[model samples]
Target: MNNISWRGIRAFLYVAEHGGFTAAAEVSGFSKANLSQLVTELEAALSVQLLYRTTRQLRLTEIGQGYYERCKIAMQQLDSAAEWASQSTDELRGEIRMNAVGGPVGEEVLAPLIIEFQRQHPGIRVDLDFSSIHVDLIASHYDLVMRMGELPDSTLIARRLHSVTTRYVASPEFVAENHEIAGPDDLKSLPLIRGSVDTWTLSKGKTRKTVHVAEGIKVTSGRVMRQAALAGLGVTRLADVYVQADLQQGRLTEVLPAWSEETQLTLVCPPLRHQLHRVRVLMEWLKAHFAERYQQALAEGPGQHFKSNLGAS
Candidate 1:
């Protein structure tokens, strides 16, 4: 308590949240023995039991639980104070842990912007986490997530970065074989390429329909799906950004323009009434970065997905 170490506090906090020393160490970056030692010091200083550790379990002592609550509040306040001071300056600096879809923009557009931002402020650390899954901002502890479309929970702040269109596409060969197709109904007849992994709901207001679009070649990644569609395996739907290059070069055709859908490119933030300045800063950075990428995201997509599958039957 007197010779309080921030490292010890962080480790202790992670341990309290995760319910174990090993987990705390993994998250906060400390060896398990080191974390245990820190906790021992903390407990000795506070003169109170902080945790009850069993062979396979960890539980907070009554005093430890109270201490955790107070510590969490204190940590939030300190984080907020630091974030506010950083934001008040023109320079956006600090470690930003972000979640994003690991696509071309993340590599090409956002990454470069992040580099520039870091160069502008040498003190900041940018940790970008690319994941296909929707990241929980509070629980997973990401500063921001550059996401597409609407947020499930209304409480979240889904800041619109830009809007993008989704189009049904297929290779020239597939189009040649199914040239008779005219509309969304035609999708039922064309060889489809979606995994049964998720329920895709497509609608034009009152005519909402949840399409169970799993058939033909199944794939998990949108990049892979686009590749399959480009290889003439089947007609698949994709965001305009994914197939932009193909659409321009005629490697892929926008088969169902009538069924095309548009959604905003967004950065989702925590639902809290007042989020930390760091999260807010990242959100602003994303909006600015996307403004530059929007033109490309709208006009063209990434290079053709690993093309060798062109001969795919």
Candidate 2:
């Protein structure tokens, strides 16, 4: 309607997307009452009952669903037009929305990199969302997404930033107290701290096998798994990027090195055409960062057991 405001449209879209006024208010920076008022104003202007509300939940009416679909298209077009206009300038400015899996990757790797990127480009604003659930990049308006493990075929433009080798590691004390673990088969008897997965697939050249570990402690966080290993709770398999320092320091000793699995860490964008200059700069920075880290890892060499520490063990 001619009487409808962009604020009202945004409020309605956000509420509908988030499924409630309270959640929408959190993201839109509006008070819940204010958001409710905006939505009411929008409904009054459109002359339709858009939402069916209860004390506990909010549901969209049939007309509301149709309206939401049309509004989403219009909003996407407006966003594209704004992005296009902004791209005319060579100056790095505008917002970039990035999504990544939460935990070690988010806390240890991306958080610092994002802080550094913001410091370098004062004109650019970055929104980093760390969640285990994968969001639809195009529909959610995300500029980029970082993912790990095997990537299925997708229309999204995928770039392999780096491949991190997974290492089965445990504390040197734990390894010393327990009998020597000669190979993957020995892992069956050892206490294992499981993280996110119950099984690990190990490969040696063409030969590959999956070992279902006997779990001692189950954790969702990689950092927690490392901490558990440091405490000598059990063995764990984690990406080298996450445990490089621990390995180098001999806080954790690598077990079954020959069976380590390499998983590719990838960055995916909706499409090259949709990416802005700011997004491109961040992507390049990320690529360079990973490359440098990989080179450093190579230079550092595989983690070694200190002779003095081994003697004490």
Candidate 3:
């Protein structure tokens, strides 16, 4: 036999099942003449007379009956396979590997949200890595990464989850002892707990200013910087999200609030085309969850310090 034609096989099956060329053509969208031609071609390919044709009617041969039965099963299986492949894309059933910083943003904010997300979507398994060191997403095959501050120009797609405003804060005891922090210039005189960056960028309305303060205690981690600030180890600029609770409880006092800098918290990932269904779902869930948490954090009292310009980009 020559190479089989699926088109001819489909036409033959339709004709045999529908009992006539006219009826089969109506259902299959093939013309009556085309249907007849396809059946003739199929018979020629098989080298057997599969149908008995006359002016009034048509009937399938015994061999044709057996062939139709087998073809029907094969076609049904093909349809099932196609359906399964399509459903795999729509259904959430995979693993998502993500990287984040090991601070309040990761442990206090994202970790709980991820746990809740996994509870909601039981099929998705999330692997979250927390470290201060940056990881190469493409090289490590990470599904996504959460980063703070200004994102450098790159091919990675960044979704701004929230805008983080930094406030220069100190313990109430420290502030009471060193009460010379009345303006931006006084920050230079006070003992400052410097993090990775030594310079502070502050903006008000249309005016922006940068101040280089003396570093009293140098730390690499934001959490440690915050802890140092909380322990009355001089003043430091920290994100409002990380210190909202402490500020509310009178543990820390906001100093020079008018000169705070606003940076962005972004979720960086590969392009949308490369993202799996579970990854997409998690991104959207994070956006919504973070937005709500951002609002709640602002609403929990000591409202004078925290700003509310939270939005997605």
Candidate 4:
């Protein structure tokens, strides 16, 4: 209806998407009473029952679902229009919500770059979510997500930042004990610091084989895996970037250098969000930053191990 407040529609949309008034309030910074009042106002204007609320759960009615579908589309268009209009202004002033892996990648890598970007573009703000949970870009309303390696099939755009070689490495003490190892098959018999995957695929030229890691120190974080490897816990597979200094200083020894696998770090963007100038700018900024590092690492020569395919499709 013409009298419907834009705020009311936005509040309603947030509640519907978040699946609860409490979640909507948390995300939208609206009080629960405020969200309820707005939704009530919206229902009064439209003269339709959009949501069924009970103590146990809240759900959209059939009519409400249809309305929500259309409203979602309209709101996305409105957001795009607002973004387009803002492009005319000299300063970029908005919030970019990003979902990324936490720990070293979030703190040591991305945090510094984001701080610098914000310094240069004073009007822009970043709301970076460092939750380790799986992310859905559109559903979660995230502007960007940083991910590593084998991405699942999705419609989102993934721009490569860098290609890093995965190395099977262990502490000097561990390597000393298992110095007889020479191939991918040797890894199966040794205790391994493993991630969630049960097997690791290694390639030497065109020859490839999958080694089953049955047991050992299990960890999810790359940083922890590195620590485990350094402690001589077991053999661990790590990206070159994580263990470069360790390899050079003899803290960790790379085993099966001939069987390393390559993985890429990428920034994923929703197609619609990628069209926005702010998101695109951030994407390019990250690409360029990583590109420079990749090049520098490459320039250090073969003795230094950086295999980057930055900006490569």
Best by TM-score: 4
The residue ranges of model 1 lying beyond 4 angstroms of the native Cα positions read 1-14, 17-52, 59-74, 82-92, 152-158, 195-198, 270-282, 297-300, 303-313
- Order candidates by lDDT, high to low: 4, 2, 3, 1
- The local lDDT score (0 to 100) that residue 299 gets in candidate 4 is 41
Ranking by TM-score: 4, 2, 1, 3
Report the lDDT tens digits of candidate 3 across residue range 190-220: 7899888889767788886677967588898
What TM-score would you give candidate 3 relative to the actual structure? 0.61
Best of the two (3, 4) by TM-score: 4
Which 10-residue window of candidate 2 scores lowest in summed lDDT? 300-309
Worst 10 residues of 1 by lDDT: 304-313
What are the clashing pairs of model 2? none
In candidate 3, where is summed lDDT lowest over 10 consecutive residues? 304-313
Candidate 3 residue spans exceeding 4 A from truth: 1-87, 135-139, 205-208, 272-274, 295-313
* lDDT of each candidate versus the true structure: 0.72, 0.80, 0.78, 0.81
> Clashes in candidate 1: how many?
3
Predicted candidate 1 versus true structure: per-residue lDDT over 44-106, tens digit per residue: 777778999899899999988888887876776577566655564554456677777676656
TM-score of 4: 0.75
Compute the lDDT of residue 308 as modeled in candidate 2: 30
Q: Tell how far residue 310 is off in model 1, in angstroms.
A: 25
Model 3 scores a C-alpha lDDT of 0.78
